[model samples]
Target: MAPPGCPAVAPVGKWKVIGHLQLLCLLALAQPGGPAWPCPALCQCFGNMTVFCSEEGLRNIPEEIPPSTTQLFFVETALASVPSRAFTNIAGSSHLTTLAFLGSSLEALGEAAFAGLPALRVLEISTSQLTALPGEALHGLTNLSTLSVKFSPIETLETGLFNSTPRLETLHLQGNEMESLPSDIFHPLRSLKTLTLSQNHLAELPGEVLAPLGSLQVLKLSDNNLTCLPPGFFLPLVQLQELFLDGNALMELPPGAFSRLTSLKGLHLQHNALRGLLPSVFAAQTNLTSLYLDNNRLTELPERLFHGTPSLSVLSVANNQLQALPARLFRKSPCLTLIVLSHNRLSRLPAGVFQGLPALTKLLLSHNNLTALPRDAFANLTSLEVLDLAHNQLATLPEGIFDSNIILFNVALKSNPWACDCHLAHMADWLQHTDALLNLQTLCRSPAYLKGLSLPTVKKEQLVCLPGPGSSRCRAEGLEPSGEPGTLPQCTYQDPVGAIHLACDPDACQQLSLHLPGQHFSENWTLGSGCGTVRVHITVHIEQDKAQPGGEAVLP
Candidate 1:
């Protein structure tokens, strides 16, 4: 006999024992504590949920699903079509919330495939061969919050694919073959906060496509082929905090491209072909903290270009064509901490260029054409720690150039023309003593005799002093006291037209003072012979200070 609450089986001759055994098995399955019931032909069971055994061999979803099953995952399966009623029995269960169809051979999502999934909150169909999304495929998913359809061969995102997901907050459609996006594709998702469309073929963003998203916080549009941004492109996203536009072909930003993004903090515009920066490009975004403009063609920048960004901390303008910077370029950026201006054409820097940046800690000025620097160029940058001036044409530098900046830790001055001369004596002294200074091999670039010699190897003897009487004093003292054979300088006093007198002191310690006419002292007085001599017919000027007290003394 069949047990109570168990379905009954019909009788047959010689099959009665087999039928009774089957009835006992059905009775065991009907009990709450019994073993799980055996699954159908193309399915397997784990507790209440069923896993279909035909995933590899099946081309469509199974027609039947257990009543207790909630979540279904078909990962890397080969389901080419989800026919009608494929999920009919599973839709009756209201507990299903998550569904993932990753790396599938699904080329299209049929209409009403997910019609009854009202409690679904998360759905991911990434890394598939899907080329198009049909409308009404997800019509009943009202509680969906996160939907990711990335890394697919999808070329078109038809409207109403997300028509039922009204409360969605995050949508990721990145890494696709999308060349254009429909304007009203995101119209149904009013509460969306984050959208990622990176790594696409978008040439320009349509203005109205983002006009409905007022609560959006983060938008990533990087790695595209966008040449220019349209006006009011970001007008609706007032609360946006992060915007990424790197790896594009943006040559210039339109006037009001960022007029509405007042709360933006991080902006990435690097790896583009931007030739110039307009003053009003970021006029509205004042709270920016990090800005990347590297690998561009910015030849020069305006003085007040970064005036509106009060909270800016990091700025990178490296690998550009900046010939020179305005004196007041960084005057308004008091909170700036790091600045990178390396690999430019900066031949000279104006005095007090970094005077206003009181909090600046690091500065990179390498790979420039700076032949010389002013005395007090970095006088006001007291908080600077690392300064790199390597690979330049700096032949000379002023004394006490880095004296006022006591907090400096590392100073790189290598690979420069460094003209080693008396003018650089103080620099050599500072280089020897400054604990923070490095690269002492910096040598002279001019005066061919001193080339390739290290600064420390150069001494006071190797340095050539200027030509003057003081420089010839040592050589003159080395000569012999005897007169030459052809020279006639042995005479003590001689006057052809008048009487000349001579005097001598017997004591070798005696002193003598001579007076001339208008010239204070004659060149012949250096002979120290206690006599006065004159050259052939050279006229002289007599001043009262040089006149002798006694008129009887003859003067030369």
Candidate 2:
């Protein structure tokens, strides 16, 4: 029996002791220099191969790692620099394939630091203080495929950095301070498929900088300081599918800038200083599926600007200074599903602006200067689901604009000065009956009685029209003496429709021509008498209820 509160010492049989001895002998043979350090004291070793060390305040690489280790992750440490041949012991077996350092204070990488990593495929150093990559620092990484160094303050990349990494496929160098690259810097990476250089200080790219990147499928250069792109800049990127160039200072694109990107599907050019684009700039990119050109200074678009993009599904030109859109702007894109044209100065749109968009689902036209909509403005949008018209200068919309043919499910109408009068009665009725979610906080701006009142709270019956024809104001003119004095025929008659009323006695019968109110006609009836008490039958002819009395018949 063992002492209290202490580990018990079990009695070992001969077979158990023999098995323990065999295990110790196997571990000794694996090290060949007696028992090596089992694992790093500050790290947690999993399965005798993966080392996970994070936030342990480690200043340098841990020593005496097992020869069978394959992966290492050192995260959020205080290491300032990586020494040369940090993994030299493991280089013999060449088992390490991934080495990552995330959110650490590493400022510099020594020369030939990764000299022994022959089997490394992934090397990620993100959110660190790495300022420069000295030449020969990655000397012996022949099998490297993915190299990601993001959010590091790297100002310059050593020339010929990728000369040894010919097989590199994906390289992510975002959030750096690189302004200009060597003209032939990327000439060696012929097999690269994806590259991201966003949030950099690149103002211009060399004309032939991308001439050798024929296999690049994705390129992200957003949030850069690029002002303009030279001609033939993208002449060799034939296989590029996604391209991001937003947040730049591009004023205009030269013609044929994108003529070679035949396989591009998504393009982002938003948040730039672009004022216009050449009419044939995108004439060659026929396989494009999505386009974003918002937040620019463009005022008009060419009629055939999108003629080549017949397969385009989503297009956004919102937050621009556009005053009008071409009537056939989207006539070629029949598969368009989403369109965002908000925040512009568009006062009106052509009746056939949306002529060919048969698959449109979401349409955003909010924050414009539109006061009225065309009767058939949205007639072709049969598949529209979300229609946003909020924050516009619209007072009333045409009743037939959103007809029963539209299958809308969401309608945003807040912040519009809606005139709650007879003109808006149709809209009110539709809002109350339709299943669409009408976000109507639109208040009335006309009709002094309904000012400052919400459209929803106001009843439809309260909307009044002009006074009826019965309450029209009539006028009698051209009254003079028509017959003998004191013996004139009396004219006393009332229009059956109450459009006009006329009454006169003897000696008061002048040439009476009464003008009917609200009708463009005059009743001219002359009373004539030769004897006393002359009773005449008056025959009236109503020409669409608007003709005047031309002649009169007198009977004695």
Q: Which segments of candidate 2 are over 4 A away from where they belong?
A: 1-37, 66-68, 91-93, 434-438, 468-556
What clash pairs does model 2 have?
480-510
TM-score between candidate 1 and the true structure: 0.67
* Candidate 1 wrongly placed segments (more than 4 Å): 1-106, 115-119, 420-556
For residues 1-556, what per-residue lDDT tens digits would candidate 1 score against the true structure? 2222212222325734543224433543453432454454444444555233325555666554555555456655677765442454553345666666766777777677776667778788878888877777776778999888888887888887878889999998898889888888888877998999998788866778887788898899989899988777888899898899998999998887888899888899988999998887877767787889988889999888888887777789999999998998877677777799899899999988888777777899999888878898889787888898999999888878888887885778889987776677877776665543376656667444456777756653334333343322111111122233334332333244222222222221111112234323223322323233323222333345544432222221
Position 481, candidate 2: lDDT: 51
Per-model TM-score, in order, reads 0.67, 0.77
Q: List the residue pairs that clash in candidate 1.
A: 517-542, 518-541, 518-542, 518-543
Prediction RMSDs, each to the true structure: 20.9, 18.8
